[model samples]
Target: MIKHAALVSFLMHLDYFDAGNMDSFVDDLTVIPAGRGTDAAGQIVVCEMEYTGVYGIADYPHVQYPVQRLLAQISAWLLDHDTDRTTPFDFSVNVETNPRDDSKADLEIRIPFREAVTASADAGGELALAGEHYDVNA
Candidate 1:
């Protein structure tokens, strides 16, 4: 199964605060439908929501609402789909608050996944799981 521990480990290498890397990071780690296609396999859904003009914590609902909705969608998708649990899936978000403007913040959501493959070794020879040549003579 896709363990929480493995997901945490994958997240440790990410630097969400780096704007230059944001595009690549999001692109590489998003799993969503593409080009009017229904197949979500090998794709990630990325959502970025921004909130502005808030003056206090009490006014944070504007930001919270969209985030909550996106999270719900992601949660629902994960639950509804019968995916290969052993393959790693990334369901994570990065929230950034403006340093100069406390009222401004953004939420970045990513759900990276891979298409499941169900096959055993082909006839005549076996496939090497690690891409190394097998010692057939041995």
Candidate 2:
């Protein structure tokens, strides 16, 4: 099992356009055409993982729980939407800010799809991601 601290460390060191990680999660996103990177809206897709409310070594225990849950949620979301079971998006992150809260951060994962049609999931034309449970924006 990946510890919260270690996971946090790994996440922090990750780059949005890291080729290795992008290739690994490609299947979780969309299928890429042979030479199609000329979409009107660009070919980059982003997935954001948010972590809010408090931060510290002591919070590691509590922090990890949500992280694991979020990971699972993302997996399910991808499985449900990805028909081709592949995506070529690059991942990124977005860290929010809170005056009252101790910590506020968001992780964004992105992919570059040949077309929006390929990036879409089977959700009746709208990507309503489980009522913002995971906030999956494709």
- For model 1, the run of ten residues with the poorest summed lDDT: 49-58
For model 1, residues 64-83, the per-residue Cα lDDT tens digits are 24445534643554455525
Give the C-alpha miss distance for residue 45 in model 2, angstroms: 21
TM-score (all chains, Cα) for each model: 0.29, 0.25
Stretches of model 2 off by over 4 angstroms after superposition: 1-65, 86-104, 112-138
Q: What is the C-alpha lDDT of each candidate?
A: 0.33, 0.31
lDDT of 2 at 99: 30
Ten contiguous residues minimizing lDDT sum, candidate 2 = 52-61
Please identify model 1 stretches exceeding 4 Å from their true place.
Answer: 1-65, 82-104, 110-118, 124-126, 129-138
TM-score between candidate 1 and the true structure? 0.29
> Candidate 2 lDDT, tens digit per residue, 1-138?
112233334443433222232111222333333322224342323232222211122222223344455445444543454333354133222222223234322433332222222223343434344332122223
